[model samples]
Target: MFYWFLKWVALGPLLRVVFRPQAEGLENIPTDGPAILASNHLSYADWLFMPLTLPRRVSFVAKAEYFTAPGLKGWFQKTFFSGSGQIPIDRSGANAAEGALISAKGVLGKGELFGIYPEGTRSHDGRLYRGKTGVARLALETGVPVIPVAVVGTDVVAPPGKKFGKVTRPQVRFGKPLDFSRYEGLENDRYILRSVTDEIMYEIMTLSGQEYVDMYATRAKAEAKQAEREAAAEKKAS
Candidate 1:
């Protein structure tokens, strides 16, 4: 399959040579069952580094745009993303979360590892942001244990707005699997979902050791952009 070919034959080897990614707690990942690997989003390289050392195939949901790019460059992009174990799903519209959940559930149903960023988007700053509750819903609905994963130093490998950077080592740490079996039937409860999601984020925070931000990463980015615009307007007026 393309996944194995890309992982073992191409990208995986290249990444090992370039980034020299290191991993700890590999034993925490279930060897032969469905499990959710929930991680903090640091940079685009976060996903790449997480699976570099893992033997089992891991699939992550990517935006639809990555698969729909046109022309030759688009073709390359699509091929690379697909071969890298990314499943494209439209993350827009009212049903975005539902659609993503459905797609992720299918991957898990196949008894494969499903990776998700509970923060929803990459952090503009280095701090960890509040996680969305969708991860909790997925774990509860599928009855899969959530493994808190922390990817460190990837931001240096590929920072935001830059295509690539100098080769640097990044580390991946996997925390123990979290079981929410006691709240099996409470998936529909918003309060319960928030509680479960917060707990997972807490573990990720402890593992990653990044400053905790109560606000979501998307909102923080928007606010930072707004501030930049305001500063530019004031400078132009002066």
Candidate 2:
């Protein structure tokens, strides 16, 4: 109810008018059954822009921090994120990835659309990072087709470190679903998981046309923050 209200009543119409999103291959999404929408993470706006174009209700796993924020800001974050059909996953420690996989599988088992940013985190430099194998593991475990989606121009709408920005048009493209039924029983094979994840990432790369980076986005973000800190210290000394 809340999801529809927001999509049809509030944010959807406004975003469409502003972003003028160009969506493609939406038919590739199955009307029924479980499927994973695997996409490249470009910016924070990628979360809102991708789903805004989709006709069906798609749920994505979000960081737990968004739900646990303090004060009125926390209340707003919780309401907004929860109403948008996002599931909160604690992204910490060795068990975090496994926990996310469990939650994704639960969603898929219920025959719902599961959206995952295979890169694990938003790209700091607009380059598609190597995908973690959790996506592949989910697909293999659930026997669901993985749809490759690309979101363009969202980085401009909301760049990293900026609370808000001038409203700009963004585009979203969905690629044909990739079926890995051939590897139905190979979910436990690490080599197979790696191969499948690479293939999915390749399709996303083609759709988004972003440069591929082999490193994870989280690592890149840490490095970027370190650089900013060092620069600030240098400026202070000077």
Candidate 3:
């Protein structure tokens, strides 16, 4: 209800006019079935442009903080996120991964589309990071095909640490669905999970054309921040 209203009536139209997003290979997404949209996280705009371009509603598992902040700002945040077809899951605890999978599976159970960032977080640099195995686990466990999605130019439109971006069109390319049903029941096998995840990441890398980094996005961000802090401290002592 709110999702439809927000998308068709409010944000979707506004975003289309602003960014002019275009999607390719949208036919690959099943109009009525479960599938995982495995994408490389670039910017916050990645989420917006995806749903704005797709006809069917796509649901993303977002951080719980987006739904639990305080004050009027929190109310707006909660309303926007909820209305945009996002589900909140606490990602701070050790069991966060498990909880997210459960939430995602529930969405799949209803034969709906679910979106996931295989890198687990937005890429701090413009490189494709090694994907986490959660996506593979979800695909294998549910026996659903995984569609590799490449979202381009969103970083330029809405780069990290910025509230607004320049007026530029973004491109969304969808690859064919990847079937890993042959590896069914092997979701618990760590090696198999890594292999499956790497395969999906390979497709996303090909589509996005980002340099493949063999590290997680979160780790890369931390390292970049540390380097910045060290450089600042060194300059201060000079």
Lowest lDDT sum, 10 consecutive residues, model 2, at: 160-169
For model 2 the TM-score comes to 0.91
Colliding pairs, model 1: none
lDDT of 1 by residue, 138-211 (tens): 99999999999999998998888887866789999999999999999999999999999999999999999999
Q: How should the candidates be ordered by lDDT, best one leading?
A: 1, 3, 2
TM-score of each: 0.96, 0.91, 0.96
User: Which stretches of candidate 3 lie above 4 Å from their native place?
Assistant: none
Model 2's C-alpha root-mean-square deviation from the true structure amounts to 2.1
- The runs of at least 3 residues in candidate 1 whose Cα sits more than 4 Å from the true structure, single-residue gaps closed, are none
lDDT of model 1, residue 5: 88
What lDDT score is found at residue 7 in candidate 1?
Answer: 86
Candidate with more favorable, higher lDDT: 2 or 3:
3
Single out the weakest 10-residue window by summed lDDT for candidate 3: 158-167
Clashing pairs in 3: none
The alpha-carbon deviation from the true structure for residue 198 of candidate 2, after best TM-score superposition, in angstroms, is 0.5
